[model samples]
Target: MSLRISDAVVWQETGEGISLYHTETGDFRTLNETGSKIWLAVAGGGGAQPVASALSREFAGTDPALIKRIVADVHAFIGTMVDQGLFEESPA
Candidate 1:
């Protein structure tokens, strides 16, 4: 699967993090540093696995279990974004 930012959503980078606004629903979300990175990767057409792998490498020397957790977290993040209508998923 591939991910893309929703057309209805607009985002901006702030000193604290990234802010997302949903035009249709008037919903708003803020992502911290890590989440901002994941959002960028997904917005750049990355899938869950690739994003997770890149994150794992960035945190090199992390425990194996933690790496697995990161993978799970990335998947969960993507799911939540889709559910929140912040992202659109498509078959690759």
Candidate 2:
């Protein structure tokens, strides 16, 4: 149930940030700032926990509970994208 970026797809930074396109489904998503950051991190080939840790450091002032909350939110967001086939887990 983890969400990860699809390595097989190609992304283009457009006028409004970036959009990811899946040639298979012809589905694309335009990302806002937070989404863009997370997308870049996943595209860079790091797993979820590392991204969460990086997010905690980037935001700062986030206590443990808040960090967990943010991580949960991130998971939810990514989960939705994955469910929609915007992302896929890497092969083991």
Candidate 3:
């Protein structure tokens, strides 16, 4: 599945981490290191597959199993963000 970043959401990078603000719902979320990377990948307008591929290349020492696990984790995290109305969902 692909992710669609909501237009109503505003994201900012702070010294601590990245913050995501939902204007429509008046909610906020903070992303840690891994989350920040996933958020950046999604916000870059690429989908899950592309994000997985990017992660694979970036962490060269990661085994295939670990890469897959990370991809699954990213997908789950994206699902939560979508459920919270932080982004739109585009199935692929």
Candidate 4:
């Protein structure tokens, strides 16, 4: 499956990262560089594996032991995004 941002939302680039506006809720959220990378990967239909790979690349210099944890975190983050009406999972 792939993820897509809500049609009711719009995003803009910011110095720190990216800002997303949820038009339906009139709420806005800011994501850091890493978060934006994850969001983009999913939004572009890259799926969970690509998101995990992207996260892995970002922390390539870090400990290898944390790889699995990072993947779990990415999945959790994606779920949270879906819960917040920021994204929807779709068939590839």
Per-model TM-score, in order, reads 0.92, 0.76, 0.82, 0.85
lDDT of 2 by residue, 12-88 (tens): 77777678888788876798988888878877775666777788667755587877787887777677767777778
| Pick by TM-score: 1 or 2, better one | 1
In terms of lDDT, the best-performing candidate is: 1
* Residue-level lDDT tens digits of model 1 in 1-92: 88899999999889878899999999988999999999989878898789989997787457898888888888898899899899898888
Please give the CA lDDT of all the candidate structures. 0.88, 0.74, 0.81, 0.82
| Candidate 4 residue spans exceeding 4 A from truth | 61-64
RMSD of each: 1.2, 2.7, 1.9, 1.8
Model 3 per-residue lDDT tens digits across residues 1-92:
77878999999988767898899999988889878888888888878778877876677456888777777776788778888897687767
Report how far residue 44 has shifted in candidate 4, in Å: 2.6
What TM-score quantifies how close candidate 2 is to the native fold? Answer: 0.76
Candidate ranking under lDDT, highest first, comes to 1, 4, 3, 2
Candidate with best TM-score: 1
Overall local distance difference test of candidate 4 = 0.82
Flag the better candidate by lDDT, 3 or 4. Answer: 4
Off by over 4 Å in 1: 60-62
How well does candidate 1 match the true structure in TM-score terms?
Answer: 0.92
